[model samples]
Target: MIDLLKAKKLIFLLVIVISSFLIITGCGRDSGADIQSAEDNSFIMNTLVQMRAHGENAEIAVEESMDRIREIEYLMSRTLEASEVSQINDNPGEFIEISEETQKVIAESLYFAELSSGKFDPSIGPIVDLWGIGTEEARVPSQAEIEEVLEFVDYNNLEIEDNRARVTKEGVKIDLGGIAKGYAADEVREIVKKHDVPSAFINIGGNVLVVGNNVDGSKWRIGIQDPRRGRGNVMAIVESKDQTIVTSGDYERYFEEDGEHYHHIFDPESGYPARTGLLSVTIITDLSLDADALSTIAYVKGLEAGMKFVEDIADVDAMFITEELDVHLSSGLTGIVEITGPDFNLIEGENFAD
Candidate 1:
């Protein structure tokens, strides 16, 4: 598991600001007359893990959920040398037997890899490690260096045989950083619900999943961070109940050199940061796993195609923040999604598509 005070996540800087990326807003009053609530946070899975729940068993529910997240980090975190993911990545082309939990997330990763046709791939580790965007060694590699690693970035090359998994190609590897947290969030939800907690707020590195309404009996109001602005500063507020709200943007993990900015989210085809002309893409959905992967796909697809891609999915909505700071809303969130960023212009995404 990701040990406390050390991580591969983009949060050490965020460590000071805690709520830098996403903020839980508008909690009215205390826990009320007779309600029990528990809230706590820790650094794990390369990001800060925050949990809050209400009910008689809120404390136990939240604690169990946090423990589950730790278990996931132990198994899935790529930086952990003994982790299942590392084992698979370290010995490419060899079927490394993984835990059911590891296999489950990897299989789902393949689903998204196929779903987006490799735009969002689990095999993006080679390029990710080469750039090292979020680490102290972060640097821009030469095109030849990028091209050399590109051959190993194909999701199609990954093969899963039941409980065992392996990258078919020798140079290929798997990194679940993109989708693991969401899976963990979904797992946390189950833990919370099983304990009979009526409400909870799970913030795994600003990727939020809220269960039930606020204590005040109103919808949970969440603030979406302004990608360029500092943390804890929000551009919009979303009212969510029993749903996951997450974003994938260039601002997450990045480095700047010679006036050029490079972020962690990569374009599988380009082998570099996605130049999708999008500042950030936020997905609001019932499943955090879906929202997490969808946000990345939409961001990599760029604004126009990304909007259309998300619109086709039923019961899911997306908010596309373009390079121009223009807020484009999917059909479902058109009239909704309150704008809180003064410099942001809320316009019809359809018109922007034109």
Candidate 2:
């Protein structure tokens, strides 16, 4: 449940996290040098990569990597008839055989669901569909309709065994939109890393995963975008060697009618958007997947509560922007997160407890 006010003010869309280059492992010791390539496809809704020995057979490696990404997209897509997720949605309460790839994602989703106290539930597909904010036909959903949809959003209803998952509840639905891109990014990074590319950065549209710094070994600098623009307007820049900067904002995806604004990211309790005072939450963590989930949770939890929530979590730093554009930070991230642009200000907090 990301804060309703922040969600209303923030609109987000799914973006791919494909890096510009690949990481070359054992670069100087093998048969020729290894080079990495990036590919964008409509099929996976993200980017793909492959690193091969720099020789005549490099094209084959590139093509194979692209195809591997497509295969993953086919198996995990919710819109596809043959996708495991679609099948699960089609036949609830039945065990669905899924690829180990899909299973890993499910496990991570469940882990974050527990960590966020169900605030970052992935079972928000019904509510998402009802609002239709990210689609062409976006509209506000009624209270009764949202309430009915909420009944199907219990993340605990999903049961996983080995490589299969079973949805015990009838109407229970799952949507990986929040965490899918990050997971996909992580997967591609591993794929490229195994191939031994020199250095890389995966920008799944906006969700960025840095495998290594620039080719010269400098820290990768990523600019946090300003939420109130169509272009990718950066608010500030964060430098990291090999880490992720994931942001969840109210301006990423949304629609306006009369004076009301509606978007995705609903609270399970009220079946409406969360009411947290923050406008957006950005997480910086070693793992992009965790950063992605925590951004949603922090956005829903507001300033104080969100700060406390992230404090207990180790090795994770957060930057929170409130509705009025006030910026707050977790202790570890205080001075390191600089505010850039005309609309942001840094403020200190005495205590941020729920």
Q: How well does candidate 1 match the true structure in TM-score terms?
A: 0.93
Best by TM-score: 1
Q: lDDT per prediction?
A: 0.85, 0.69
Model 1, runs deviating above 4 Å: 1-18, 21-31, 349-354
lDDT string, candidate 1, 1-354, tens digits: 112243333465565554654455555456444789898889899778888788999999988888899999999998999999888888877999989999989999999988888888999999988998777788889999999999898888888888998887787878898999999999999998898888888889868898888776778888888998767788998888999999988876787888888988999999999997899999999999888899999999988888888888888899989889999998899777999889999987364333
Pick out the ten consecutive residues of candidate 2 with the lowest summed lDDT: 13-22
Give the per-residue lDDT of model 2 (tens digit) for 48-162.
Answer: 2322222233344345545665776776667677888888888888999988888988888899888888998877778878887766567776778887888898899888899
Q: Per-prediction TM-score, please? A: 0.93, 0.82
Q: Stretches of candidate 2 above 4 Å error?
A: 1-43, 46-69
RMSD of each: 3.5, 6.3
lDDT score for residue 208 of model 2: 73
